[model samples]
Target: MRCETIREALSARIDGEPEPVAAGSADRHLDACADCRSWYRRAESLQRTLTARPGPPVPDLTADILRRLPPDWPLSSVP
Candidate 1:
């Protein structure tokens, strides 16, 4: 993949949303592109930091959680 294409997909690649074939191409691009390598490092650092932190506390957690949940029954009205 070209550097521009790889750069465009870098965030999604870091988020683990990229297809395996595209990931291989992006990885190969990172090996040769210094700018992309630095970007990849920064993205990796951010992902790690975000995952390590405790998430925000929810107020009225029971009601809020229930409101956000998907309908459990197949025929249930979601909204």
Candidate 2:
């Protein structure tokens, strides 16, 4: 199987979606392909890193935004 096809399967599997290629075939390719193995490792690591973060807090700016608006601005028109 082409590396692209196997990579697609790997990505699908990582995302909990159906794999484009059979698991056994993709596994066999990954076993013999160093590059694909490396790609898969990086992809998994990235997913873990992204999902593990407690992201920075976002400050609520609704009041500040409203205050800056023109006094005569119609509230109904804002939307």
Candidate 3:
């Protein structure tokens, strides 16, 4: 398989989504492809780093948002 295709499958696998290619096939490719193995390691490291840190706390804007909208803002006038 092409490197591009294998990478896509690797990404899907990393994301816990279904891989486009079979797992065994991707693994076999990884075993033989040094570039792909490096790419996968980097990708995994990046994923871990991204998910390990917590971002700034999110503010609740629900009330502020609702107050700015008209009562019937989302509803069309009936004929």
- Scored by CA lDDT, what does every candidate get? 0.77, 0.95, 0.94
lDDT of 1 by residue, 1-79 (tens): 6667787688776777764456778878888889999987987898899999998986768676677676674435536
Q: What are the clashing pairs of model 2? A: none
Badly placed stretches (over 4 Å) of model 1 are: 19-21, 56-79
Which is the winner by TM-score between candidate 1 and candidate 3?
Answer: 3
Q: After superposition, how far is residue 53 of candidate 1 from its true place, in Å?
A: 0.7
lDDT preference between candidates 1 and 3, better one:
3
Tens digits of per-residue lDDT, candidate 2, 2-73, equal: 999999999999999999878999999999999999999999999899999899999999999999999898
Please provide, for model 3 over 1-79, each residue's C-alpha lDDT reduced to its tens digit, 9 standing for 90 to 100: 9999999999999999999999999999999999999999999999999999899899999889878888878635533
Clash totals for all candidate models = 0, 0, 0
Model 2 spans > 4 angstroms off: 72-79
TM-score of each: 0.57, 0.76, 0.72
Candidate 3 ranges beyond 4 A from true positions: 57-79
Say which candidate scores most in lDDT: 2
Residue 2's lDDT in candidate 3: 98
